[model samples]
Target chain A: MGVSVALVITMLELVGLFTFATSGALLAIQKGFDAVGILVLAILTALGGGILRDLIIGDTPPAAFTDVMYLVVPVVAAAVTFFAHPLLQRWTFTVLIFDAAGLGLFCVTGTLKALRFDLGPLQAVLLGVMTAVGGGVLRDITARETPALVQADSSLYAIPAALGSAGVVGAYHAGLPLGIVGTAAAVFVFGLRVVAMVRHWRAPRAWTRRRPEVGR
Target chain B: MGVSVALVITMLELVGLFTFATSGALLAIQKGFDAVGILVLAILTALGGGILRDLIIGDTPPAAFTDVMYLVVPVVAAAVTFFAHPLLQRWTFTVLIFDAAGLGLFCVTGTLKALRFDLGPLQAVLLGVMTAVGGGVLRDITARETPALVQADSSLYAIPAALGSAGVVGAYHAGLPLGIVGTAAAVFVFGLRVVAMVRHWRAPRAWTRRRPEVGR
Candidate 1:
């Protein structure tokens, strides 16, 4: 890992964190959660994925917890959304774009981290996709909603991430310059997500003859 | 640290995993999920908490993944529930008892693991409670239901685990024999959970003047 590459990854992570936090804060606002809830959701959405990634790779304390900058970014994003959400609420598309960027950035970075930890390419792809979607899952769970990732009617979310992660792993294994390949992969994922959202593309739901019902 | 203590803790963990898996499998049956869903939920519910704890403490590959018995217990539980669900469905109280037992055993074992990893007592207690309830939370989330831990109308769940974890931490700090004290704490938690269920005990929800609604 060159110094320049590390710096780039850090910048990408910061951007991803800020965007994810904003989305979480907006969702909290929409959910009628209080101010404290907004902050909690924001922080969780920002750091949850990275924390999960580090944990899987056996990193202690998690990088997000150790770095003050990572913590500060989400808090700042939450506070901004807290005061400015009324103005931001009209721009749902902007939020979707930001979320796509996060999905892209996290998948690449997460795959890199897993590979650095000596995980196989297959496992790396799994962890990378998890890193991209884990925070949103946590946020939805805390907000008492079914996570969109598993919702049959929801637009494609994890597929783009899996593709991005697989690309990164392939690039790494082929001895390609990761800094360039990683950035390209991230952009590819972001584009795919935006297209999926705009086109309302959905993953296939299970076909069942019987009506599904939840019983106590 | 002693061989006998290690064996005892392992036994508790296996018991906890089996019970949690059973609860998860039952939930899958209630949700009308397929056989694969039942197995996935059972494995996740049995191993999720322990894995979370291990990740926090930088334990790589997670004991549940590395040890064959840990994986085997959940598979067996899921198979039992899958074949015998018609009979098991009538015994809701039995399922609840198993869940309570899991809660008790996990709280004790989780705290002990955290303490061994040199986490502070407060942090250890938090991790312990998380370990006890984390599986249930994951299970509910996957089943597309609000986690019982945070649901306003749900019965007291995390509270007993917190109390048990606190007692375990206190006992550890006091240099008491951990095996005995830990067993006592687990028993105390189990009794508290069963009583709470029987009595319909609930943790208070936040009082709100405004109507609460989830908006998209």
Candidate 2:
């Protein structure tokens, strides 16, 4: 049962990888990165977090090396964006959904990997959060823009991933069915993100004081 | 004695950080990254490896947070490069030396950290190698270039760091004087790199058959 669920999750993760790669490539182009930059961003967005996670876990010959599909997916995604850029721009929502799916899958995969490494729950959740957003963070930085995570106040990006990771871990510990639990966790994260986008729900920000008035 | 040696190495690492950050920032400007991109590259080159090292060791908050100097050095380096790029370009050799220093320091520091976590010698050495070169790999990919490590015809970059790390660990186990051992390791790695650069020494490539002969 766990094996089947893991396989399903991996498949979803691949789709997510492709989507995320395309989004990264498009963003690089939008930011005026050259063709080389676009390809680089695409691959980085798809592979960076996994590489970091694997390295931390002492997993040699990282996932990108062992899996031909992982390598192929991002390249094909980048090529599609390169050729169909006009259509992609016209259909921005298509990319956004893919990005969302990718985000959900990565968060789950990252959380699971951390748990497999026997990390504490909080650490597992944090790793999940990092995995979900790390690629986008790398993409923005490479393109030389303020990271969307820091700049986009309206997105509850990290929160949803954190919650999903926690839910999966919690359910597993509580003896919940893996398939039901994993699917529910993914759906919860995906739903929350979509809702946050549509409703413009945002994390609360602290107001900054300007030139504090003489020890008021 | 060990503490003093570590402090000296850390100080050199900071200097190296400043130099590498400046190089990254200069490259960003050359690529026409706005202020944001330049700063991102600068920070990545400065903190990327250390951050990876800390994370692998499960060090919460990472070194970047513990050492305010780490943060300050990269920002200052970026600012200097932003303003004095023309002068920096002429001092490329100086920059390379600084980068080499950072690489050597990280190689040692990463190895020590891995040992502290009780990893085997091979694992510790591998971690050191990863920590030394990981940032540059990330930076190159982000900048849309091939990682120097994977370049087919490049001289030995990571190999020297690996050898240096092994030397340090071996010295520690062999009851050698700590200060002399570390200094020797650093100087050996740095001198080897300098020689390689001057001599254009490269790793031997495997020979491949240009054409297939008919089966006997």
Candidate 3:
């Protein structure tokens, strides 16, 4: 709530937004989408989660649409990716690192926002994870690709976000200073996500079970 | 609004929800998803559009979550699909008819809700179309299918919703009685959608354009 703390949160949010936008734009370029599609995907990827969060919490118009800076950042990020994607292709891992950072930061902030809205702890955690991963899900769906969220082959995504959000909720309930605790939680999620990617970690599929072709 | 009008709207909404839920559940069963997956898809498809509409307009918690009847309708629809899907499979065209009816009803209701929230006419129309088609989009994405909204091969879907929404918006601004105009619009949308489906109408894709492998 303090000015300095708010400023730090804002800075982190911008970084998260930028990373998400870049990821979306790069994907659009790779998919052979047009310029308009690239811009739309980038903006949606950056702002979709927050917009979803605000809407669920009864926040009207959503902060992303209201704030000029929030809108501008994604456009700039898209432009950067649109022109320089070939050059940026070599740094795929670097983009993934930034995307992980965004996922981490979003989970913490989203959880805090839900708590502020007086949602129950469990609901807050759910919303936090949604806020972290929802945008990428939207991007993939729009591009007609299978979302990594539900793909067994994809590296761990939602688990890190859930852990980050759970940690934030715990710290908040424990009366810890959010400025420090929140940052720590984000770093933890970021590290976990990066490690999962490096190690090619995956979520487990359901165990094989017998079932009749018809009802039980 | 009068009590009778409210009752009619609620009835129509339930019908819409049931149809959407049936569609989702059928898709899940076809995809060989488990019982839980069927229920999840059914509920999400039934409620997703209204939830999106409510969130966008800052109506928190969403009516779908708050109203027990709304929740109950979808569950019943899913149950019907799960237990009697073989019987229901014979009525695939019948289900599509019901889905078109739902689409028609939702566009009118969604536009009216947006207008109530003081959105501009254009914005209201956009929301209306979103409300009508949003649930189906979510169902398709969750099932990892291409959304018909963007698929050129698919029959006209969002188009009917747009037309219905636009009519509602125009009638409202012209001070026409919504009860009458809204119903008329819904009927028009339903007719158009069924015709499109039967005739195999499709949206046009972009024309061929020369481009480098990289950016223009």
TM-score of model 3's chain A, to 2 decimals? 0.92
What docking tier does model 3 reach? Answer: incorrect
User: Judged by TM-score relative to the true structure, which candidate is superior, 1 or 2?
Assistant: 1
DockQ of each: 0.17, 0.04, 0.13
After aligning candidate 2 to the native by TM-score, how far in Å is the CA of B183 from where it should be?
Answer: 2.8
Q: Candidate 1 chain A: minimum summed lDDT over ten consecutive residues — where?
A: A203-212
What TM-score does candidate 1 get on C-alpha atoms? 0.63
* Number of the candidate with higher DockQ, 2 or 3: 3
Model 3 lDDT tens row, B1-216: 456546656777888899889888776665555554566578778888999898778788677745667778987998888777766544557657767887998898888889878999999999999888899889877878666678766789899889999999998899888888888998999999999999999887667687324211
Rank ordering of all candidates by lDDT, starting from the highest:
1, 3, 2
Off by over 4 Å in 2: A1-133, A137-216, B89-95, B211-216
What is each predicted model's overall lDDT from 0 to 1? 0.84, 0.72, 0.81
RMSD of each: 6.8, 11.8, 7.6
- Residue A15's lDDT in candidate 3: 86
Better of 1 and 3 by DockQ: 1
Candidate 2 clashes: the total is 1
- In the range B89-205, model 2's lDDT, one tens digit per residue, is 444466556667667767877777677678788988988877778777766656655666776556677889999999978876787775676667767777787777677788766
Best by lDDT: 1
